[model samples]
Target chain A: MATNIAKIACAVAFAAGVAAPVTAAAKSSTVTAIEERGTLLCSGHNGSYFGFVEVNDKNEWKGLDIDMCRALTTAILGDPDKAQIVPLSWAQRFPALQSGDVDVIIKATGWTMGRDTEVGLQFSLPYFFGGTQFMAHGDLGITEAKELDGGTICVEAGTTIERLAGNYLKTLGIEHTMVSYEKASELRAAYLANRCDAFAAWGPFLAVLRATELEKPDAHIILSDQLSNEPIAAAMRQGDEEFVDMVNWMIAALLIAEEEGVTSANVEEMASNPPNPKIARLLGVDPGMGERLGIRDTWAKEMIAATGNFGEIYDRNLGEGSPYKLERGLNNLWSHGGVLYAPILD
Target chain B: MDAAALKLRRSRRDMLVQTLLVVFVVLVIWVAISTAHTNLTELNMTSGFGFLERATGWSYSFSLIDRSIDDSYSKTLLIGFLNTLFLGLICIVLSTILGFAIGTARDARQLGLNSLATVYIQIFRNLPLILQLVFWYAVLIHMPGPRQAFTMGEVAFLSNRGLMLPGFNVSPTVVLAMFAAVVLLAVVIFRQKSLQPVQKLLLWLVSGSGAMLLLAWIFAPADSSIFSIPAQQGLRFRGGIGVPIELVAMILAITLYGSAYIAEVVRGGLNEVPSGLTEAGKALGLSSRAIWFHVKVPMALRTIMPPLGNQWIFIMKATTLGVAIGFSDLFYIVSTSITQSGQTLELMGLLMLSFLLINYSLAQLVNFMNARLALKGH
Candidate 1:
């Protein structure tokens, strides 16, 4: 009887402890409406590479990934800066979302069944795509990854790249030891220091390292190995279909922006008077579809204004202005013979 | 009341309270453990020590163990423990010597030498451990490759990869000479302790240097071929013993950090001796050294042993940071284990226990020493 009372007392105390924050987050996640204020809690990468989540000299966060986070903010709050970026590591990212640390995860996280079913996080449209590639210092004359029959390869520890590197090496009948590092930065350092004969990292990161590490800047090359698929995209926890729909539609709309020649500079004008009926309807000229998503019809327009159109954001971060200087291969628009497809906004 | 009756009552009351406390603890443990068990189980997480038997199928980038992915988790854990011990032993030995030097130098009355000691401590303390590890791994290890090493008369080869030195070969003559040299060195030291001042100092220096030279010259021809490490080899650098850069850098950092504190402890020990003892030595017509050997060192140890233990424990923890520098110590092995075996919970538990053993055992050892050195029987 006494022990039961003690257990009851402890349960009551624990319940009391979790009561307030749970209530607040519960209110924050109420359906599709705003929680308390005009804000959207978006999570992002603390450190990835280049256009995704590059750190400047002052240690400030800004990149294409930041643009993706801003889009969600503008979608709900009519302002992009309202989104808060909660940069998380690969290990911490899933736990952060499952625990409601943020409303969404817009980091360069890959979509997979194990993560989806196991962690209960739902994937949105792919914001970008990349694959693993083999890179080496140009002087090694190792233009292809297959030539590394008796060489050393470097990869980030505890990542998919380790397994992919192993499988690819096996396929190529190569005999190489995979030197795993805890972080991409360490792997890059080791590769540059010539500790390893070759580097196995994502292609975009290879481009970034090339821009930074190489003397002639073409001193390293990322071979067309395509070791594994990295279908990188945004994610939110399960049981938030309203939030999912809002984010998904906005993505489709952004892809349509590319299809309809909508630049960040031209987005505002396009929103005011989009020529086509579908674009007009999407701009909320005909009838506000925002009513269904519990927002004003001009929500996406607000998102675009805060950042830019999909094409503008892409060009700024991964294109000529950025150090990555990626050539928009698979990430380009449908009209450009790429995989980025957008359904009719109507 | 009678004395026996009073003692019986007290004992009974003590037993009742102890029983109640045990019951209380048991209940608390029950709740916490049940909560963890239920939550983890419901979350489809299995927890057991059975994961130790599973094969950890993966290749290590850098490790102390020749691990196949086929090595069991238990083997991985043991490898991790050994790595920790390797780093710990090296760091502890270096720190003890470095700490003594730094500690003594701190008490040196000279302005420049004292300030240099101060500067050494300050500069190292100011830098973050991780940054230092990176700098060591990158800048220090980036020195010379295997072939491009700097050789000093073929006796010493310093490279970015390692520092190579000629370790003596163990032929019967060489071994016998070294053994004799050690015995003679000890006898000379002990005899010098009791001899007259000027004569003792002269004999100690002469015999020590002479014995060292005699052995060196006697073994010179054998040393030329057998003792001296061959500078040239086809693939692996042969003959010369190679000490890895990772080992050097970790030892250097741990010793540098540990020694500063050891120096401070040493200074405190030196300061603990009353000035009157030295004055008494002068009054009794004794030299300055006699008072120090008897009065100061004994008392200083009482103050020194505790903090020295704490510094060693810090070293044990600091070895974990060796993972950052590619030294496959406890943390590195645990990480590799977790990734390869997928036994996150079991590996985590093992990691915690391994570190706890190292730290707790070190504390126990220090405590034992402190007790031995404590003022005899209160």
Candidate 2:
């Protein structure tokens, strides 16, 4: 009798184990999951990436990436406050997303072919454009990156900047050593301590550091050469076409809103009295855009009202409205001599 | 029932139970692999060891082997393993010596010395190792830069970059001769009682030849100078062996932390030694020094070996703290590989296997030493 009961228990456990993955696979979309959980998990930087992702004096997250995460959360769950930021290191971001620790990776992640194909990440449309550059001490008397020979260069590990810097140096036939740290804070510390001759990182981040973190800002010189132009985007796990499309269009709505002269303050006015069909459709006055994407018809309006348009976000975090006061450069609108454009929303 | 019949039935039951256990474990493993495979396929990620052959377009700060952006992942990982092994071995040797000294000092008759040893152990052993590592790293990097390096008679330079020492330009033949001299010295020391007269004479000849080769290499003509002193060039010191600051900081932290633990192990082992044996040695007219070395240490070693082995393994594992300081050790390399190659499972498996092989060898060595030092029966 005991043997029979043991056999039955073992059989039941085996059956349950076999059924688990199948049930997990049958789940339809990430949107439903977010709705059920009532919070949208978005990735944030482990340390401050000033102007992109950092805390303010008030101890609140305020940056371009943080605004993007809030916009995504608002679009999905209709409340920006429902966003939960999960801080992750550069190496931990991919694994965190793959293991379902976060819903979307809105960190300042570069879209590379290796990350796209090999790492199994599905990226949304490019939201920000930037370039990689090097910063060196003024005492080195070196003006160009090519002059940094037989010196050590510090960079953040598990980043595209590390690879780009190495490749660029090798292409110029310059010999140097590369040291990488896992956190931006550690990299900054090493560079400041003069442990390495030069530091390599994203261009805007280098500028921000020079302006804010450095006591003697003129003591360091950012080299003029652009190593590589990176298209920064949001990454999610693959095999969810509906979720990917929603995120992609959510980014498009922001750009279109910016181009159509719609601000967070004027979004409600524009929706109530849109002069053209494009603005009407974008603000959900026509109602088909949101239904097709499996969301409320006023999703775009809610998202814009929560996190303003793309231009406002750029200005508030990184451009004239912030301490960095950086130029838009390649991040400007397509009509204004930039590469960013959204497809026509019909 | 007969006793033999009952024994046979019990053996049959044991066999059946063992078979069931094996089957259950195998089934569980199979289920796990299948699930993982299915999930990976759905995510469009490949899972295999094939990614090891792909080019790793990154560079490490310090590597024993020649590496480049074009090198394959396998080569990079091998260099990382070598770096870790080298660091672990150096720390093990230094900590053992330091631990023995401190442990002996702890048992000293002098109160001040004993208290000093006690304080050192308490401070280092109680502090977290990661904090210690970060502290040492901060101290090292805060030193003066290369241009203002603290020079040791211009032969060696200490700077935030590293301790740059004057390197030798010896030929391969000189290195080979030096190796041969060490091997011959070991043979002479280990087999002195059993060596024939002719063998001893041959050993002497080899040692003499090795010494002559080294002297010749050292005194080669002025144009072919054997010493390469570090001199400031461009952004750093050139023409000498440059040891990066990361390696120095990692070794210092691991050695200090590991020594504290090992000192305690030594103290326990020595305390547990039978005091009657020391009294016996004294009664036999042994001198104080002779009694301490010949009576106390050997007996303590038998008890010390097992725990000392554990400390050695722990020290090796602690080398992973290299990542915190950006020392390009095996764990750091494998983690970077996971991000670059996206073969997380395979890379992680490789890392675990490599560490297991390393620590297992260390454990076996400890066991062998314990056996050799153990008390023997008549």
> Can you write out model 2's per-residue Cα lDDT over A154-182, one digit (the tens) per residue?
99998888899999999998899899998
Looking at model 2, how many pairs of residues clash? 0
- Residues A113-187 of candidate 1 have per-residue lDDT tens digits of 887898788888887878887886666666678777656677777677776787778777776656677876776
* lDDT score, candidate 1, position A144: 78
Instruction: Considering only chain B, report the TM-score of model 1.
Output: 0.75
Residue-level lDDT of model 1, residues B49-87, one tens digit each, is: 788887654444444545555577788678778878878
lDDT of 2 by residue, B91-166 (tens): 9999999999899889878999999999999999999999999999999999999999999999899999999997
* Model 2 complex DockQ against the native: 0.59
List residue ranges in candidate 1 displaced over 4 A: A1-131, A144-153, A164-179, A193-195, A211-215, A223-346, B1-6, B59-62, B125-128, B134-138, B141-244, B276-295, B339-342, B371-378
Candidate 2 is scored at a TM of 0.68
Which candidate should be chosen as best, given TM-score against the real structure?
Answer: 2
